[model samples]
Target chain A: MRKKPIPGLSLLLAVLLVAEGCAPRIPGLERTSTTEAAAVRADDEDTWLKAHYRDGRVAIFDSWQVLQRTVEGDGVLLGADRDTLAVGPFVVPLDSFVLFETDRLTPGRSAPGLAVMTVVIGVVGFLCALNPKACFGSCPTFYAGGDGDEHLVAEGFSSSVTPTLEATDLDALWRVRPVDGVVVLQMKNEALETHAIRHADLLAVPRGPGERVLADGAGAFRAVSGLNPPAAGIAAEGDIAELLRAPDAKERTSLADSFDLATREVIDLRFDAPATGDLGLVVRSRQSLMSTYLFYHALSLLGAEAGSCLALLERGGMGGAQSLLQPSEALGFIEVQLPDGAGGWRTVGEVGETGPLALNVHLLPLPAGCDASRVRLRLTKGHWRLDWVALATLGEAREAVRLPPSAALRDGFDDPETLDTLRDPDHVLAALPGDAVSLVYELPPGDGDWELFLEARGWYLEWMRQEWLGSPDLAAASRLLGDPAGSLRRLAPAYKSVESGMEEIFWGSRYVRAAR
Target chain B: MSARRASIAAAAAALVLGGCAGAPGPRGYLSTAPEVVHTARGGWVKVVRSSADATFGSQLVVEGELLAAGADTLHVLTGTGPLTVVRAPRDRVTLVGLHNRAGERALASLGLSILSLSNGWYSVITMPLNWLVGIVESHTQSRVGVLEIRDGPWDACRTHARFPQGMPPGLDPQRLTLHWYWPSAPRGFSTPR
Candidate 1:
């Protein structure tokens, strides 16, 4: 007797067929040897380990070696130890290292657990789909503050404010409030504490201007727009003044017909210096196009000049030996000098290799113990046109400003205008002290389902230590704060009935709102 | 079950199985099978023409169909004309049959469309997933094949001679030559079963 066909058999068959179809197939005629396959598998294994394991965390083991004998460290496993296992600074040969033991954080081993959790969640989701209301009540929808006078105080409040002011000191407490559709900080200080500072006033803090001197023909040095070429065998000292008087021309020859100098020919530029601050010279130069074009086309052009040009190009055009001479190679350097108190010119720095068709600022540092009052610039090598020279005061030596361990609490403040001002790094540096500052999003009353999210923006461990919030684990910290629902929870008590949806709902690093 | 209902179910099952079976695996000049070449009588064939001289490199790939199969030479109809026959020496030329799955390509296109429809809005999450799947799928399949030329042009005899209607647009006959080549026959060039 023929048996009755099972229901859904066709569907099952279809699924099986699909699975079989999608199953990876080995090419019929292709021969993948055991060695090749093993090599490929080893490569894949190494790749997986590298991707999942944090640097220096994986343990390396040799053949017949136990886990205890494995070399464990916190650096990344570079690759399979064919010769040596390169884990950062440490390297162990393949004869000694064979196997890899993944760290706790490695996703490969933990993937099975995650997959199981995903399946469990999927099953729960299927059940929920059949009986939605039984699994969860109406999903709470949160809205920002509308037109209302009732202000709900933001929870998890911590402030940098303290009453440590002297009798004459102005102790102030700042808080942002939406006024006339603009978020302005209301400052509470000793004299006029209740006044609200304008958003513009809070935003615009005056920045210290940089110390720079623009030397445009108006300086103490004789500014020459153009100069004539020096006569042959002219003294280096005389040629220096002649070049200084020459116009800022593209080609070295155009400034003065025969500007090319013999070895050690010095073009001295003198300028009066300032009394204080470290002085630096900036030379604005223009590189010629002919030098580059000639350099590249030297081989094609047949002549002694072409040969010399080609040689120069190979030896890094005109200035110094660079890698390659491109069409944009208009670069040259000049030795800077300041009087060495010992009655001689002291070489401070060399500046050049300016960009093509653009003003290149070459900063020349002054020599140690040199007299800035007698600052001078001397061109010793390569032909280049100088536009103008500026004396800039280098930044003074000051203690490095260290950013304090800070945490930016991102509540439901989606106000871009206000948030931009609040989150500005410059504004934070200027306004707040090295203490915690709360950016409270004062919502309208009756909106009970508000979720709070805490973001450890920078230096999380240090911030946690400072706050005495115990471990960096979000769930543990939330539990310590009398929050039973954990870091990922909903504000409403009705939503707290189901913890299965918590992973999906609280996707990122967030604090679950405590049930009221 | 009733006859009509069983027929409907059977039809549905057949349709799905047909879709899966007809799905095109992958397409490339090197990956073409000999069976495909035999069946593609009037269809286009990509021919890699090697030079008789060893010093001068005159290797080129041309798209044509078999015009007349001789004992030693293959008269192929090239882009120039039917009269402009390319006398490809049987020993010097390699012929590969191209088979592109239209249905499988449609399915893949549909799958990509669905993925794009869902993930286009949330690209941050979907983009990575899409890339990962793509990488995995690409590594799993053989997209390109290596053409292995043999001593005799007897392989051309297995392929029938027929005049093709016209060449497909955007098909560059000259540029279709395989990037990789060997002086002699390479492995995995056995006659298709």
Candidate 2:
């Protein structure tokens, strides 16, 4: 009877065989954290395995070899001291691959691994069996007939010979190679881990396809998947052929404007805080344009934390109510005893709505408001990106309103809506503290000798991490952030300290030893 | 059911039960094995809920030391004795050394001084022999009181006469302590409500 080929049976059989050939899951090998877990497997017999942990540590045990099964739900019983050791249930984290080695089998002694000679012959014969059309033109036995064909002819060979042809020379065609009990497994931080026992003296050789990991082999090996995954794919990189492209002037301008704005915003929040008075009024009125820009940006980042103009005016420390009265506004004045004796009162300026948040500051000549001189600015637009700062006579009380702790802590992560709400300066200022305490939550001593104080309603005070008896210059600060030789250099001066709810940047300390 | 059917059913049930077996257990990594142990003791884990309650308060105070004198400015550290130092036009002459704290007795060794002569040129002097000498002599329409030493005779520092009682105009550090009394326990940090 002529053989009739079955349509889908082969495909179904192939899938079943592949599925059955996979390893089984191992148990108790999972990674457990505050958030996640993992497991591993073996595939010969239907059993479970458990990793042993004692006294909060993973137990290291003597190794015993057992045959690994290549069928689902099968577990191998690894005996220890004439008794069954812990059984593990292995489940590979989905979308992960495990590379492993199998034992080599030999003639007469049925070793667990596949025989090299047998594999060679099996591969050649399989190709021939699958493609009968290639051999149909010739007889079963062959004598040198096709051009210079060697050896006994196919016509003379027996029909049961199976006609083997080993392609040993084609190393490129081979995917699996012999390995000696070694394997490397890689899993992501976001995924599960797998388990595989390691022998004392086994070493692995590289073979197979996707992302192979070779082991150094010493103990029972288990590779738990990491919680994070490897990047899915690589992005394209490399120089491309030049192609002429030009945009319209209008479009270009728009793009340029957008880019400029972005850069400005970034610089504003990152480098500067905000000012309390008009941009030109603070810092001895001697601030540069760049500093002014930075100051405004910092103000934007502060959101509502920045105070109103009127509040700035009322600050007696600036000069007193008299200095703020537009040189004509009548003021209530009083002078008490000063430490040095014989002090006077004078108002500088005041600007704002009459409410508590209003800003009014009295300005003295150069050094009167020195402590509160520099105006710091933060990014009030597009999330909490602190980019710029300016030093003005008035400090950052008005500009720091953008990134107040309460609102910053509540903004949604990675959301654009949160970014949108942070852009408006008025809203930013509103978030700022009306008084001093809100601006300064905590102040800790620095490096033993340096003392840090929060300048009430002052930008420098707000960002003060630790101030040494002697202040370090701006260049020294830059060195601290840029130097790689020391950890202090690499240490970020600014961070929201969890213990104290304050956004702080470290200012230089006094060199006590130098002073001594 | 037939015996064969029962055997098959038994295998199916075993498979189901086995699938659910070995649910993940607590982990032991790093030095401390998180609070998972307390949570895992209960079989068939249950999700716990969280809650929070708020209590309001009056006011808060921040304390720190004042450093050095600035140009046209005088900083007073007021945590100790003789907290108030009255400045007079005669440079260093302290008008009235109100030592009422030490049973109305003033420290004879304590004296006041003026270092610089600025825009408001007026003769500056110090009275070493007596405490109330400068208060009776210095003639100035306005006086700048710098609260210097904070610790001392409490009675003298807290004396109502030393302060005009209505000076700074806004919040009286001596009287109007709003005393904010809010609970600091963060929201959603407690057991289920």
Candidate 3:
């Protein structure tokens, strides 16, 4: 039996052959025969040259390579040694001699050639589709959530989500979610732990009654002259003024004029607490100078309780001097001073170490039937630097003080349409009292990929003063007003970790169609 | 051969021929006996010479005015104010011009198109055949121009080499290619021919 010829193959072959046959010719010069050359020479110079040679006729040579130059001097027929051809400085040996040329019809653009190039491009595209790994290496995977929201677990480029609640269930509620803020939950089981709950969790707790400030150490307080005068009068804006001195021998003594804290050195501050109801005091304190290795200091709150003198002493140590310190290590203890009825001070109830100054709140509960009036924080056991103190009825104040708005915390996207309406920057700012402020936002979902971008702005007051003490440049004037550059660099990152913690929160995912 | 084999053979041959047609030839060469060499009285010309090891040898061609020509040597004024002397033997050194015919170019282009279609369905059968033929018959020839000597005395040659009117004085004229009737020439001497 005879084998059959493939008709499709034959058709394709014929088509290619015809296409090649119809290809456009490239324009170039052609050599004329001797007779034709004679005829050309007989004609007028212009006509003959135009008809026979191209306008751009110049000699080009190929030695080991092609070297081209124009004909200048008239021919003088020299030595015919088959070894080399010397034209001015150039020497062309006969052995390597290839060829020389004038104008030649080089290939011009061809329609057929273009079609072939297109086919080549198509083939490349097909090959690329075959090896998908080359086209889409390690494409990101996304999981759709139960709410129909896409969640990207891993493998996608995106900005990080600030976790509101990572683990555990909290029944308490907050007006505004703290960026790097935490909530202390005193469980019914007598267990106390800090929790980073979501805004939803904070809403679960019932709102408390209105609150009023009973006593604020940052308020107007008269300083006594018997001991070393500690710097008073709002040293750090929004914070109570207290002595801040480096650990120097001359400054450590009670008699020294610049004593930061000394034994028996007392500061008389007057505050009106609730007369007859259950009341609590919140004390905000940090080490005078933020130092890494510092001696342990004890603070005693002395106040009149039911017509008697009372003193509550609390001792604590400062942790790492670095910019980022834990709340427990950075904050001092809060003491509730009550009267012992024999003209002596007695401790009624006391709260453990508070959070960092301007970060966490320290609460102290007053005794029943106590007449809240004058209070003093004296250096009892060790040295201490005080920030401020405030009193409120226990469980009465539900919300913290509303703080001023700061531009650093504002989101870049100011458009109300895309803004996360649930976030309130003012509420979070009011909770912490200090010269420095931190603003955090829960980035909206589906704003493309998330990337870590931190921008901080603030200036250091000490550095500014030093500049002023030196030559007094314009920068000093700006620093006096407020320089955010220094503070931004120091605080933004610390606060981000505080707010986000270490847990990863995935937001949305996207689906992309595979290439055919 | 069987019918199927014959058909396959014909297709293979077509592919081979179609692929080899567009190969280009050598760029240029020098000639000893040129048939027609036409140079205007004061025209610009370039000469190229071939050397051994075609890739390594240096072949330099001079471009300048026809200053002076003798029986064994020709002195030409260069563009940079230097005079270059070239030794020429009768019917020994000539400038070759090159050109490609239209027909040959068309064929070559067609061949290229076919070879580029190597990814097509029929390419499985035609690719090897086209490659083989392409290797054998790729190059296309270029036309060559023969340099002819002008019959004139050395003094007359110098007179012919004078810078045209309005040409800047002391400006090297050899760098320019002299053409007939250059539009940018001085008003009176527009047609150098």
Which numbered prediction scores highest in DockQ against the true structure? 3
Candidates 1 and 2, the one with greater TM-score:
1
> What DockQ, on C-alphas, does every prediction get?
0.01, 0.00, 0.02
Using TM-score as the measure, the top candidate is 1
What docking class should model 3 receive? incorrect
DockQ pick, better of 2 and 3: 3
Considering only chain A, what is the TM-score of each predicted structure?
Answer: 0.25, 0.13, 0.25
Tens-digit lDDT track of model 2 for A264-309: 1111111123233332221000011121122222233333433332
What are the candidates' interface root-mean-square deviations? 23.1, 46.3, 17.8
Model 1 residue B93 CA deviation in Å: 5.1
lDDT of 3 by residue, A1-516 (tens): 998999868976765665455645443333322212223222221111211112111222211122242222212111111112233323333222122222223343333433333343344334323222122211111112222222211111111011111211111111123333322111110001111111111211122223222212221111111111223322212223332221111111112112221223444344533444665555433222211111100100111120111011011111212111221123233345545667866655544221111111234555665755544444422223343454445433322222211222221323331122213322211111111112233333332211111111111100011111233233322231133234222333433342221111100001211100
B12-35: candidate 2 lDDT, tens digit per residue = 433433333212211111011122
TM-score of chain A, model number 1:
0.25
Best candidate (score: lDDT) = 1
Q: List candidate 3 stretches off by more than 4 Å.
A: A1-204, A208-266, A272-274, A286-332, A338-344, A352-358, A378-387, A395-516, B1-193
Which of candidates 1 and 3 is the stronger one according to TM-score?
1
Instruction: Please give each candidate's TM-score.
Output: 0.23, 0.13, 0.22
lDDT of each: 0.30, 0.19, 0.28
lDDT of 2: 0.19
Off by over 4 Å in 2: A1-459, A462-516, B1-193
